[model samples]
Target: MWAVSAKRESPPVPEPLAPLIDAHTHLDACGAETAADVTAIVDRAAAVGVQAVVTIADDLDAARWAARAADWDPRVYAAVALHPTRADALDDAAKAELEVLAARPRVVAVGETGMDMYWPGKLADCADPAVQREAFAWHIDLAKRVGKPLMIHNRDADDEVLDVLAAEGAPESVIFHCFSSDAAMARTCAANGWMVSLSGTVSFRNAHALREAAAVVPAELLLVETDAPFLTPHPFRGAPNESYCLPYTVRALADLLDRPAAELAEITTTNALRTYGIG
Candidate 1:
């Protein structure tokens, strides 16, 4: 594990001038089930320059909530899909609901959907390589049909994920959410014109590989996220994360890319907007 400089308590609220987009987040997981919760979260995010957020809902109920939230709040966008880990639990009805969700105006992408083999128990139920491949292929085709980018969530199953992506011919604007891949994978994704969305994990001192990968990716294909309510950046590693704390990860990315924090902010915000097809 790597450590970051000790966290000083956040200073007075910074001016909301920087243009930023948290391309991937779980606003629903931020405990926002009511209008008040939604207002509070969006207010906090807006106060810190998060002009927009693409919130993902991995299940049917959450997907409904996310779509409703997006409809209610202009700043929120939604991505609806069945996560690969939950593939075994998805039935025809769930797929039908996802298809319906995909057509909604504010639902911009197809996922936080992809492969994950991080936990043995979860994988046991979804472990069949064929099942994972089919699920990934289905999502890829859905994105193509809907003309939306696919937001990928990859864990220890990189090779298989990449293989499926290649075989299925992923959409041009795929976003590898919370991307923590190595330079080789980064280069491959870059070569294929996929966007890499960095999260708080990149701030860890031990994450030299992730930093190097971040540096090598083209600025046009780079993005930043908090993966909020999870993976809080170093120094605040143990704290629950929110959109307001995003600058900490942005600052870390600035260091990694050897660019001014503001410049990195501009570049990443632009990249995220393009990737998510937001204004």
Candidate 2:
């Protein structure tokens, strides 16, 4: 019989890369299937060039954990709100709790919240057009009140999302995280002065449209993120993603923009800082 060692294994260490920001991430969900796994996941993110991450919460409990994590780790920033897929879960108590969390210094944005009908689950019935509109309005107002930019997540509902933003009036600095839309949508977003954050999907071979979209987006309006522990880039698509793997995604974006990876990194880093109001 083989004997197992008593020592615990350390998390995977990430290789150093040029400084970058994960404009959108769920640090609270990174290996956070249990309480003991949260800290290690964040530590791994910091080990890489993910200088700062806007950690989003889908509910009050996740928001509370995100707030605590941000307070403990200088590199972690919090974004408190109900994700669109979980829009029905946002009870009055949750909204009240988020209002308080939003005031915390480490809370930078109010999202990972928007519309998604492609694979709507529990929210299929509750997160209808009306619910999404209401939630979007509330979150937009919260962002304005707190003086933070809005981070959005739009999947298969771009028209509705754009219409809502235009109608309700979002802040000047709105970020479309993991923007996997077409060139026309990209052009519209750029024209409206919104930032489009690219993710691993941009690297997929079948994402030519996304690549075309990236190519035309102005440098000042482009940002990159791993959406880690979810949209892992190619060459490691099947593996669990982390911020350290951002270089692969960045490289792909660079190729799309016809610029050197270093230059693209600098441009996107600056854009992210500007969009998120980070120093």
Best by TM-score: 1
Off by over 4 Å in 2: 1-15, 32-43, 46-48, 121-126
lDDT of 2 by residue, 206-255 (tens): 88888889888988998888776677776555566666677778887777
TM-score per candidate: 0.91, 0.88
lDDT of 1: 0.80
Q: Tell me the lDDT of candidate 2.
A: 0.76
Q: Residue pairs in steric clash, candidate 1?
A: none
Clashing pairs in 2: none
lDDT of model 2 at position 3: 20
CA shift at 27, candidate 1, in angstroms? 1.1
What residue runs in model 1 are displaced by over 4 Å at the alpha carbon? 1-17, 122-129
